[model samples]
Target: MKKSQLAVQLYTLRDYLKTAGAVDRAFARIREIGYEAVQISGVAAPLAAVKKAADDNGLVICATHAATPDLLGNRAKVADELAMLGCKHTAFSCVSDFQIIDRGAVLEFAGEMEKAAQELNQHGLTFSYHNHNMEFGKIDGEYILDLIYANAPHMLAEIDTYWVQYGGCDPAEWIEKYAGRQILFHLKDFRPLFFTATTAPVGTGNLKWQEIIPAAEKAGAQWFIVEQDSCAKNPFDSLKDSYDYLTKNFVR
Candidate 1:
């Protein structure tokens, strides 16, 4: 399948979502830019309003990213809200604060995630975990991400390419290795520095998008959400440039 056929994660337009009437307008602009699907984050509008905006703008809410609190404690309510907005997947973008401490804490957090995944499965919705750099830390000679996946093999992951690279791992290799376990990815590019990295538009970074995109597709990734945490210019312009660059050059 074509990369353009994939969805855009609306968190990429977080600035717009914060503005008045911007959520509605952003969906319209997303459609205008040839995106038919979106993964919602920080959706401030009512479920009905969000659904209406998506429908009016010809966009499909394929998945949603929520806080761990929203997913673990208020899952049923959150699931209902997502269902009302036509979302099929609910992804936890970050873990609870307590889970940030050490390896043991991470394992404990993984157990909680497993339970949450089972709960979400019962609700007829798929659950996913979105990764950040910290998840790549080594624990007992294995990455924390590996431990989480092992603990809950059924739970899906939305891997962030930039974070994968930031953690000193190859995102494409993981895509191939974890095929069928990762259903989505945040396809942000990163520029490698001496000890840190900087994010840039897709092809402008050292992410090896040429290899990663195809590997993700082969791994059954249904959505590739282009995300840049910080942009030199406005977020919308950054997204537009990234979208154009990907469609015109990177995607085949």
Candidate 2:
């Protein structure tokens, strides 16, 4: 939280950034709200267009979320793509067809991701796993997330604090447990008593950022990417509010 910069995960702006032009506007607005960086995910614009827009607004492309298919089908292109954005951190968001709750299934899937991680590493990119609550299901006395990470220790962990809390675990604990393996941390606050587990900006929900922030810093997290999966107000407003909360409470 005492870092020099904070970033917004573009997934929070997914619905708003539907087209090339819209993506451009989103970057400009993010800059206006004092966000110096962004994690690209669920963005549908052309890679060149996205890079140009980020450059135009002086917004750093900090990290990204990629689908499994893209990783399998386009490894080199993925490398080239991140290079285009001047981003070295990328992650596989989730598995599409694999059984996330089963240890055997997850280990096998982690094997595939391990291969991708190694290949991407050769290209100077770090490939990581981003978890959701579903990964918290226990298999043989161990969480699926832990099992998969244990089997594939080389892949980085992009821990989502909100999902970890949703899954009944302390985000700070996992951040501590994973220590040197965490390269990116997703900051999403969970508002209590909301149907479908509504998400709020960081510090607006029940999460313990007082503890979460120090834990992340102590564990040496590189970036805290703020993401709200659902916003009660305009998405940009939600982003600005999150930005204000982080800058006011954490750091500029």
Candidate 3:
């Protein structure tokens, strides 16, 4: 089995990670909390400075959630930025527009991604799309999400288990369906409120991590990123709880 490391998405700490100095302190705290890897996003520092912080603290940037405009606009340039951070795994994170409802818009996006994936592959980088519940609506007989992946074979799937559940699908089933294409898996827990689902730490909520973790491992996932968009307590403490849970239980 390929080793899967537990990584925390920096976006989970976005409120605390803005400037270069803030990023440095956050990385230091992450290391102190025993997280050895991170998935970068929303950091304002230059790529060199970000790389330096990770290197200085012995943190590995396993993947990143870069801007969608940057990825679809100039993939080669994005590839250069990723290379600078010694990162080969990346995803657009989410779609900001409702154009995914239009077939033509999806096709256009897929075409751009095909070329971008090719460019990224040439640079030894992998590209993927991270989903939210909005992607659940199906087009034709297939999901817009599945259609996008089918259109670009080189583009990988970075499945978020919680979103899959929120979208009314079994996350493990989707994980198995995209077996070989997943490069990074987002590990988040979900709990039902009155009419909606809310984010929780990895194991403290309703997610079946045992099933999800093994499924992702079977699918060749390299990093399992713990991400909780909102937390009830201090966000860092919530992250620490998740990090400790995964380390003690799943990660090898």
Residue by residue across 115-232, what tens digits does model 2's lDDT show?
Answer: 8898999998998899988888888888888888887777999999999999889998999998888878899898877455778988789999989987887787888888988899
lDDT of 1 by residue, 66-159 (tens): 6667666887887787778877787888754468567788778888888878988887888888888887877778888888888876689888
Best-to-worst TM-score order: 2, 3, 1
RMSD (Cα, Å) of model 1: 2.0
- Which is the better candidate, 1 or 3, if ranked by lDDT? 3
Q: Write the per-residue lDDT of candidate 3 for residues 101-125, one digit (tens) a residue.
A: 6788788777877887888888888
- What candidate 3 gets wrong by more than 4 Å, as runs, is 1-4
Clashing pairs in 2: none
lDDT of 2 at 61: 92
Candidate 3 TM-score, true structure as reference: 0.95
RMSD values, in order shown: 2.0, 1.5, 1.6
